[model samples]
Target: MERGTRTPGAFAGALILALLLGGLFPALLASGAGGTPAALAVCVLVLVGARLGWLIGIGERRLMEFSFWTFTYVFLGLAALVQFQTATFSTSTPWFDTAYNDDAMWAVLIGSSAAMLGIRLAARGPTADAPARTPLVDERRIHHLAALGLLLNLYYLIRVGPGTVLLTREELWAAQVARWPGNGLTAFVVAVFTLPLLVVFIGLLGVNRQRTDRGEPPRYALLAVVGCVLLFSVNPISSPRYYSGTVILSMAAALGAYATPWRVRASASAFLAGLTLLFPLADAFRRQGGVETRFAPLQALTSGDFDAVIQISNSVDIIARNGIEWGWQLLGVPLFWVPRDRWSEKPAATGSYIAEQMGYPFTNISSPLIAEFLINGGWPLLIVGMFGFGWWVRRRDDRMVQIGLLGGKPSGMDWILPFYLIILLRGSLLSAALQFSVLWAASWFIRGRRSAGSEGAAVPGRTGAHGGSILTHQTSG
Candidate 1:
């Protein structure tokens, strides 16, 4: 593989390729009579195609462990495809009629293409000779963090009560839609609980990796398993399927970051297949009435496909109605620590605001990334924002590699950051910010222990320059 800067011609060619591929959306829309379903199908296809092209052309050099590539696959690729397919063929009707317009949809596709191209162009070239640091795992600190996490989990369970997770699917759905305002302290407690979980999760990953490397069974295996079960159980039992799936999937990505490429692929395929098969069944639980036993997973794919396209369309409508919020939507990120009740002027999450404008009962639904940016400041800001985002992701990747966290042996921060990409790319920047803050804090705390040892020692089984190991003895020991 070559390790040099990308030529200007190659960059231009890639940009051209993206534009041509993006044109497929408008062409498909025109051909399909400008129907909502057709527009959605085109969007999904373009998104998938753009992502695949990215992975093939640029991802290999960067190592596709937990980059924006994975984020695209989960949200833009899989989520969009399933929703489009389900809406097109399933017996269930869409949640609402979309105000589908060819012009708006085309703009979205164009913006998306520009975003993808911006990301590609901003990416740094290969750096095989870059200096690498060996990060030492502190088992003692990890154990302490895990214990703290357990306490937090227990506190949350107790505060919410076990009955919260024991509700029937119908009951759970009602609760979600109700959006009950609990005591003022409820939000505070929830935040406290969430912070520890992030720390504990990262700590467990570090401990597990160290134990495995030492040829010892994972010391925190039981704790990890229990934590996952509790984590998944708490959210999915009462909330949406995506919530629970996100927890499990991110955990899998973290744990499997160091696995063979084949293993990672196999695991991801199995996860997606399972999610597709079970999506309808989960929906049955969330349905307003009684439980739906006639689960048609294939048909369910089309069921409830209203969110993505409708939200994008709604966001466009919102900008026309009220003008661009001009970053007002992002105020929640900085003021996240302030409770909405106390801070009466706090802004809503972009997704929630869009949903509210659309008159939907559920404001917790998605607002696509492109739409969010467009609603902020139109195409110019969208392009700039996406390029900055891509640059940041690239920098994070480089940091991982420099810290000896890539190439089948990732440190805790490597696992934490990539797993959070799922949320970052999925939209609702405010929520992503809050979640990321906790994870970033955890990563900082658990990065590596400082020791009075030489940093030049080589890692076992891995060689660095001049026949020396890249990992220091302190890190290995």
Candidate 2:
């Protein structure tokens, strides 16, 4: 079998290796052999090995897996180790060596176990035995998405003032917040970030399809323009890191840079390094009136970027005092379509609520999925919720990998949502809710799911987009 061809991989063994290596990575980072038993650090490193290794070593190289593990390894793992030793955190009030660290570590362990259970169970299902479905792309629709994307981006550019789009990350973020309730930024997301992304992927799929299904060339000209515009819109300097990451990584996946096991592992390793080293420097462009106090990459991990660990600890503390919100806090994300004016009694986001309780001057802290699950209904929900997420990821991963291998084509959701998840995972859900709402709606609108017929791919030999097997094209799964 081709190494790129689908393989069940050594899932069971991989998980064991992930635990030992993942736990070991952070302990090494903490202090060679070290003190405090480093319980939390162990849990985090174990998480990195399980979550990160699950994707690179055993995963099918799906975009969703990359997005999921990237959070575990980069944003969560490095920061945890950094804090364990330095005993510093992002909060104004100190949150180090508190009573909650051990308990929170247990919570982390429980939640991850539940998630892994879901992934394992899903992999055993009957559907995992079925052949993957193929979807025919509507060339006409690709044209529509491209036009729509350009129109929306152009309108957003005008509304925000053309020059405003060129500001630094922090400055641009400040400008968007200033636009308030009536801001045109959502338009930017729907168009610049997602729509053109579809244009490029759909265009590539069309190129590969000509050999298998034997079709005409797609509008490569339009794809060229859209691709260039997407680059301009998502430049690192002006856009938010998460949003920029979504677009750029999705584009790369569409090109097949992340399809094979070796490629996925290589990219995953590089990604981990980048998050540890380069992610801190990202703030160089993010701070207003920059150059305040620069620290090395390791020290910077204790800053706001790594606060998901702190936020989880904070969530655990909140549950002890106020108890979970029952289910009220969970309602806001699904019902995000309802305007704030429409739902007067809507609950604040879990992050904001926790920050309020903690008396932080800023409410823009992260609340990871585990934190959300705990806040919603405590341990039961955390277990059940992660299990559900795992099940869903496995189901989707199997399907998307199949699509990559057999069809060489994918839907808008196939590559997009996974990257968006990076932000959602590092989230104040209410803050992220509207953006996802618009993003999902746009994806649904041009959903590349085949309208009819079973022929979804062309021959797999061409070196079309990012120089990978055309069969796995976008999925590189």
Candidate 3:
């Protein structure tokens, strides 16, 4: 099917139906219970329903866009639902004490949906004129960079002590609290290195795929396989979900970029199924005594009973008690460069502050972009911020498409920012800013060296129809 072919009326109907089913089914199931369950269900439903609606409305044309929405809305929506049900089912000691009303929930859901839709509408049009294209850095340079990154990560792992990762769940948690540089710093470093490593790895995979497509020997195949295994093995064991999930999701997205639509759909379905079944097993790998059976594995995955939602809800409560920060929280992004010891006035990251407010000992929980915007300036800021975010994503994706980075073959250049885009979409402003800064610096260092001979090679392939090559790149998958 063509992109954006669904009619507005069809989209509206689908959205309405989704909202009704999402809200009504939960309410009906919980009718005899207290009102909180119903309220929580409504919030979960609306968020999820809106996401489905948007997906149906927009249709999937761009892999980055699809991945962004799926992660931000659909995945988070499911998590929210799981959290709500878990909270209501498991405890009477409200995780979030604020008034749980349908109005507030609807406001958040509708505002978010509107922002997404508005951005989509604004971004739709003919492709914009792109700037000059530069040849990608040579494979040898990419390999060298990959080797350097691998060595750095190895040094970091040794410095941190391999025992930290090898510990039992109880031991792991204890070590986590007492560990030097702390979880925040560790997470930051892991994120920073992972990006470039992924960039090189994906690039090599693309090159290898292109070579294979041309009936050439798969020279880099072994390197790609080994790199994949090493990257997966080196992930921080403490936070298995985020660390490992990021890598897995990124790889899937990279592959999806070069896949046919039907294949993308099938892969997505398989991924969701696998995630649901394996989530409990993965959670087991992080715990002290192996998996605790306090709740069923399926229950944990289905109820969104995970820590992320708890953090998000906790953030919402904190915002309700303390007024909005009016964007003061944003200073944490730029000021992150300064050490806290040197700059005592540096604002605490939103996640840390929310954790403190909730009296949680560990504060590494995620404060999603939605909660961040909500705490900054309420609905208006959220709507505007989301709109801007959508616009920016579109501009970036379009530019990449224009530069022949997307939609045909998988190239190393196409994977880097898109992987980061997934990260940015899910993280708070401070985290996003820090990660983006590192990625930008890495990109600068690893960027392709332009040579006169390579620059003129595109002349014969140029087409005036789209102001660039409308034909798929010869190197495309």
Q: Residue 366 deviation, candidate 1, in Å?
A: 2.0
Task: Report how far residue 463 has shifted in candidate 3, in Å.
Answer: 10
Q: Rate the local accuracy (lDDT) of all candidates.
A: 0.54, 0.65, 0.54
Give the clash count for model 2.
6
By summed lDDT, the worst window of 10 consecutive residues in model 3 runs over 468-477
Best by lDDT: 2
Candidate 3 C-alpha lDDT tens digits along 319-399: 678878888887788777777778878778777777678776655555667667777887788778877776666655565
Winner of 1 and 3 under lDDT: 3
TM-score, candidate 2, is 0.83
Error of 3 at 262 (Å): 1.8
What is the TM-score (0 to 1) of candidate 1? 0.72
Question: How much is 79 displaced in model 3, in angstroms?
Answer: 4.4
Candidate 1 local lDDT, 218-250, one digit each (tens) = 766656555664574446556555445555555
- Model 1, residue 409: what's the lDDT? 46
Cα TM-score of candidate 3: 0.74
Candidate 2: Cα lDDT at 377: 95
